[model samples]
Target: MNDRVNEWTPRTRAVAAGRPSGPGEPLNVPIVPASTFVAGGDFAYAREEGTRTWVALEEAIGALEGGSAITFASGMGAVAAVLDLLPAGAGVAVPTFSYSGTRGLLDHAAKQGRLKVRRIDPSDREGWAAAAGELDLLWLESPTNPTLELIDIASLTGGKARVVVDNTFATPLGQQPLALGADIVVHSATKLIGGHSDLLLGLAVATDETLVAGLRAARTRLGATPGALEAWLALRGLRTLPVRLAEQSRTAALLADRLAGHPAVRRVSYPGQGTMIAFELADADTAEGFCASLSLVVHATSLGGVESLVERRARWAGDAHVPPGLIRFSVGLEDPEDLWRDLNQALG
Candidate 1:
């Protein structure tokens, strides 16, 4: 263990951070799927959790965020844990447009008279700072869900309230919200981390000991622990994250750039760091037809997979931030040439 798990490059840390003490002896950390443990007990029970399934995810993501990490049943589970930080009837400030689940959960809590929720202009630094005084928690997203609006995390975290980032879209690779001073980073492993979309999972990483303890307590009390199999799949997905990210991001950048120049496209919206991209067509009708025309790219809502996907994000709810014609793209390891060709024909 190094004093600075925090000091390594993203590539180095993503692949190498969670080696078993006997590294090289066992290639990957074995999935310890059990409800019980021996008295030698580094870990007591699977429900209570252990180091193997998540220690790797935690250290790897924590090292990247310069914090400690916790694994959860879904990204919203991690969000629920962080939301536990606020007392009953406390105020929370979040973006006008974010993942539907986050907004939906807050709305659900608000309906239940648990918290006061407000949607702020996500890119407005002063708006965040102004609202921070009244807030118990501040939520942020960079290159936001479908619109890809950029927010300076350093600016967002500056105000009084604790800051929580939905880093699922950006992944831990492209964005370091914790390093920029956010209190916690939450991700839905159903996307980029699981790569194949075969598993449902969530994670939280934080430098604050209080938030870490609170997350553990919430997951424990709420019974949101993931099964051993999903954790194992997420672990496997992570090993190739650096490789997957590099290739997919490279392809996405190219695809977005080419699409931007097309007469049918009104705009392109990927920040060029991760595989997620969103573009809008000149007409909403054409955007629908274009998606229908794609052969190589599947028309799917979820992103971050080994195969490319495109979806009409505006068709989904809470699309206030995204343009009505916006089409989200999730780049995969597919051939860049074929992807471009598919886009060309689809747009035509």
Candidate 2:
């Protein structure tokens, strides 16, 4: 990676950081599908060394997050790598409301005697400060999944434990957790980073060399390496992340304000930034009706794609804690008026 590229703005760095800088080199990093290399080279086996494609993706993401990054086969893979850093029966503090996949993983580990898990609300500062002294890891998500709750990351760092922020929702463009004193930042590149929902990939970024090495080792041991093509695709998607997120966030803000005024919406959960919003109706039936009534917005799971998506949060058993009438909406690049029209008619 070029140290000089660090001088550029994040948007500029996003496009320029991972490109082949040498004269006559291809403008983009080509997919290197090799699993083995010739003797005496920097790379030997792909599993341990990684391919050029993965390196480029890591370089760009690391630059954006202000740390060194390691790619994984899936977002859960990255989460698992971070958890692997803990010793057996390690104590962990996590958000009571977070991505279900992450919650499920911690629950499974606790059940198997692999970890001691403590669940706390993301906004509970006192609980976090208390956990900081006793826990091995502090896992947090800001503008948390479905709920859009923000955490004071800087206030929660500098304790006995390592702080890991899941930046999947906020995105690096929205916030750089490392800059705010977080020990490590993780992302489900499958979401906003990939931008198109076409691939599965994850990343863990940290300025701490030891943690970075541990994450890499865990990826190798767990065989959670990302595919070469997926890396290349994510890189392509990343090139436009800044612009895409900006437009989507703008649309989200507009919709959030509009939804707050709608009689059908009891409440709107929007942090005033990012592309996600959650609104509540009268009941589960009303929420389902709103999703089914939409003409333009997709009624589906997953988020941060070019096309809007909406679903009743309580429809999923794992998310039963969320209000039965709550609708998790992922705003896209559609025209603000068009989206509002669709939502208005749906609410009626």
Candidate 3:
């Protein structure tokens, strides 16, 4: 696997996309831990732009997303950069079932008269399509967080608004929103791109270089630059993303089928071919017990790690739209049988 992966398959690209092609360069990207470069030229300060490590990651993600990429300190930072693209009082539409962090930020901004926000239901494809023309921007999260309801990227992108799809859950391998006519694609690289819970990172990719520049400038002004170490680590994780997602998706599909048939599960919301799964129990108490009973799967809030995680969505004060008994399961790289054994015993 080498740096030249443009003509290669996604699997090959995942492992080979951003490697340095110099005669004596290392196979993996090395961390450029400089906060300030030697002055007298551009890249004088890390806060103003970012280091080589960050660029390496951005390039890798850009290749996958079919555009240029920008990295931020965290997922919220990237979200803020995108929102900052809109002028004050501009109109934007977002999914009601999307990530709570982004939703909460939008809600706060709307109340403060920063932006006008309309909540769209991901399952309501027709409504989304109709509202798209009236919006200045359309923010989408297909297979919306918590509940796995998908949205039609192509139909919504055909409208007047500049479409920005949150491609965190689907990742670049699963879906290329940019290719589908979306203006920008964003990811919580802390999740799938990192493929581990070790770092906090976020990314935004766009076919239009101007839009990417705006995000870059916003990140610079906000001082939302990611650390070199985290950037390097994320690049390391990106190499194995294809393989990791394949295995996790496989196990999740298996678990989703079994859980859907179980009497204890009221509903199984799995759109298919992704690691994330959301299912419902009878009530909040039952859901809490289910989480507690799991011995192998950790009871955690974050997802896309090497280990499995399950938590009740309604426990978070922000995501009330999610059912009280709904548990967001993040399937990890574990044996399906072992995970089922833990889940089955926990169900009882």
Candidate 4:
């Protein structure tokens, strides 16, 4: 609300991050759905950069990440754009337990000789730092997907490589990667940032203007710009991100604590923050039944939504390293007691 935005808390930033409403203008930003802007103007085409709707969303996310931000059609689109920043023979290192889609993309690029991919254990800070010396890019996903294992991002980013951190699981409210020495911060806005599961969008933020320009050019060439409506929806969800994350995170911790004591649950993995909770059942066989019996929690694939979702992570072919019975639980806005009752019944 004031010139000293950095002095504000994350909740304050989330509620009021975007552009200010001009006098007589709509309180909320209007969606500019035009493919092409007026001739002889600054914005000649939407794909080249973005429209006002997208800019508003970018500014909001950027403000949270403490850098300039760009929106993409999907999370993978943002990932690809970052990868494109590297040269053909560049070496890159990524987490062994990162999001499967990003792993697959890196593997595909490796196969084509576009870049060399090295899968490094996230917990191995020494190995990561060693790789960073030779790598052009180091991609890290803290509290890795499904497993919830965390790495020392500051230590990893101290090396020579350009660091790109995926902060999707730990929303910008939970962790600011840019502040931790990372060169770039990325997020799947479709998840917690959107709060609702209705839209698909991604965001990348960085302090370097040249890198941001390159990412924007890559998005334009690849035609991976986000839709106006999706941008607008994501912006709306972002307005309440702090509130949703607060409730979801509190409920998730409660569920993890209770699940740790359950007989059927072998182990509960929580980073002690964020909305994601992973717990393992007896085996792969019991996982399906457990998921099937949940009355209130929806059995779904994606995480970070308004509704609780439970899914067996090992069912996906890409996540073989994960335990056979691991369930990636995404805590939502539901009451903790109600959620506990559902889990108790489901486990039974």
lDDT scores of the candidates, listed in order: 0.82, 0.92, 0.90, 0.90
Give per-model CA RMSD: 1.9, 0.9, 1.4, 1.3
Per-residue lDDT tens digits for candidate 1, residues 1-348, read: 445556778878877777566545576677777878886767877656654766776677777677888888888888888887688998888788678788888999999999999888766777878777767888888877877888777875666788888888788888888878888889898899889989888999888798788888888877788877888788788878889998998988888889889988887877768898888886667888999999998998788889998888778766644677888888999999999999899999
Any runs in candidate 3 off by more than 4 Å, and if so which? 1-3, 40-42
Model 4 per-residue lDDT tens digits across residues 1-348: 236667778788777767566588677889998999888877888888589899888877887889999999999999999999898989999988889999999999999999999999878888898988988999999989878999888887777799999999999888998999999988999999998999999989999999999999989988899999999999999998888998888999889999999998998999999999999899988999999999999999998999999999888889988789999999999999999999999999
- Please tell me which model should have the higher TM-score, number 2 or number 4: 2
Give TM-scores for every candidate, taking all chains together and pairing residue i with residue i: 0.94, 0.98, 0.97, 0.97
Candidate 2, residues 33-111, lDDT tens digits: the string is 8899997988989999898999999999998889999999999999999998889999999898788898889999999
Q: Which has the better TM-score: candidate 1, or candidate 2? A: 2
User: By lDDT, is 1 or 3 better?
Assistant: 3
Extract clashing residue pairs from model 3: none
lDDT of 3 by residue, 31-105 (tens): 888889887876788988788788778877888888999999898999999999898999889888889999899
* Backbone collisions counted per model: 0, 0, 0, 0
Better of 2 and 4 by lDDT: 2
User: Candidate 4, 167: how far from true, in Å?
Assistant: 0.2
